[model samples]
Target: MAATLRDVTTYDLKLAAPLAAGFVLFFVTPLVILLALSFQTDPQGGHYGLTQYVNFLGDSFSLGVLGSTLWLGVKVTVLTLLLGYPVAWLHQRSPGWARGLIMLLVLLPLLTSVVVRTFAWVVILGRQGIVNATLSWIGLIDTPLKLLYTEGGVVVALAQVQMPLMVLPIITALSRIDPNFADASSVLGAGHWRTFRKVILPLSLPGIVAGCLLTYAAAITAFITQSLIGGGQMLFMPMYIYQQASTLQNWPFAAAISIVFLVSVLVVVSIFNALGRLSRGYANA
Candidate 1:
């Protein structure tokens, strides 16, 4: 028995070693480099202190950019949740062939390169795009409305891109819920709406939280969609970091901005996790 237990422990360690090494090499090492660089001086040879962070925090323009980035993340997350929940619920209750079709539609965007997807949106939302042509033909306006290079355009593109990530998790949670619960509630004289609100929603909180966390994190870190859709007008944190790092060649300041953005994402994730816990506790109570 002792020999068998020792062998099991050795097997577990062997299985874990490669993953641990990869995590340290790929994720932890880059993060450590970024943190160290954040504390260093920029290319102009200022003293190595908190000068980068101080300058970033003190600048009103930087503050506005941060606010816009964060607000965009929130808007994208909320929009995805609102649209994704019903789609996921319907997919969960769908027949086998219908389920396959829905899943295919959801995952189709993921199969394409992000650059390609953003370009497609550019074509569809551009001034001479299908939408504008249709509106003009129907006499909605004398001229095309400006859709590209705007916040609304960015939000629309991102929500469509990230909707699958939101939907899959909700579908998973809904699938795990037994249909008998709803039936039992109906037999107990509860209406469908009440049963859904009191029973289905509480049970699905875990998936909602998981989906929101993923969607919000992705939206915050997004660059391609924001750049393409907003056409350099929307200055999100990732875009700002890219400009600082690549265009200005200020690696240290860029690193500082990245660290701040990382902290903000972590804080948002923590809040979502806390809300999930509270929801579960209330449901169980």
Candidate 2:
């Protein structure tokens, strides 16, 4: 037994070796470098201090950018959840062929490049694009409403782009739910809605929480979509970081912002996880 256990442990270590090495090499090393850079002086050489952090936290413009970025993340997460849950439930309940088709449609966006998808939104939301033309033709409006270069456009594009991520987790959670629970609830005089509310919804909390975290993270870090759709009118943290690093050549400040962005994501995700745990505890109780 001891020999077998030792062999199993060895096998597990071997299995994890490549992944561990890759993580340290690609993720941890770069992050350590970024953290170090965040503390250093810029190329012009002022002083190695908290000047960047102070400037970022103290500036009203920076604060506004951070607030808007966080707000956009929340909006995108909520919108994705609202749209994804129904689609996931339907997909899970679908027949094999229909399920396959739905899954294909859901995953199709992931297969396409994000730049391509954002550009597609650009075309769709543009004044001369399909939405405006259709609306104008239908007499909904005489002039093209401003969709491009707006938060609405960003949210719409992001929700569509991240829908698959939200739906996939939800479908996984829904699939894991036993049909027997619903049947038992029905036998106990519960309707479909009640059964879903008491049984299915609680059970699916894990997936919903996971999807929210993923969607929020993606939305917050989104650069290309914000850049293209927002047209410099809207500001997000990632775009700010890019502008500082690329255009302004302020690497230290950019790194500082990046660190803040990382910390903010971690903090928000932690809060969400805690909320999910509390909800689960309440449900279980």
Residue-level lDDT for 225 in candidate 1: 90
| Colliding pairs, model 2 | none
- Give one digit per residue, the lDDT tens place, for model 2 in 161-215: 8888899988998898888989999999999999999999998888898889889
1-285 in candidate 1: lDDT tens per residue? 455444543444677889999999999999998988898876665467898899899999998999889899999999999999999988988999999999999999999988898899899888998788899999997899899898998998999988988999899888988899999999999998999998999989888989998999898787999888987666889999999999999999999999988887788889999998997787676
Q: Output the lDDT of residue 260, model 1.
A: 86
Candidate 1 has what TM-score?
A: 0.93
Q: Which stretches of candidate 2 lie over 4 Å from their true place?
A: 1-11, 279-285
lDDT (C-alpha, whole model) for all candidates: 0.89, 0.90
Worst 10 residues of 1 by lDDT: 1-10
lDDT of 2: 0.90
- TM-score against native, each model: 0.93, 0.93
RMSD of each candidate relative to the true structure: 2.2, 2.2
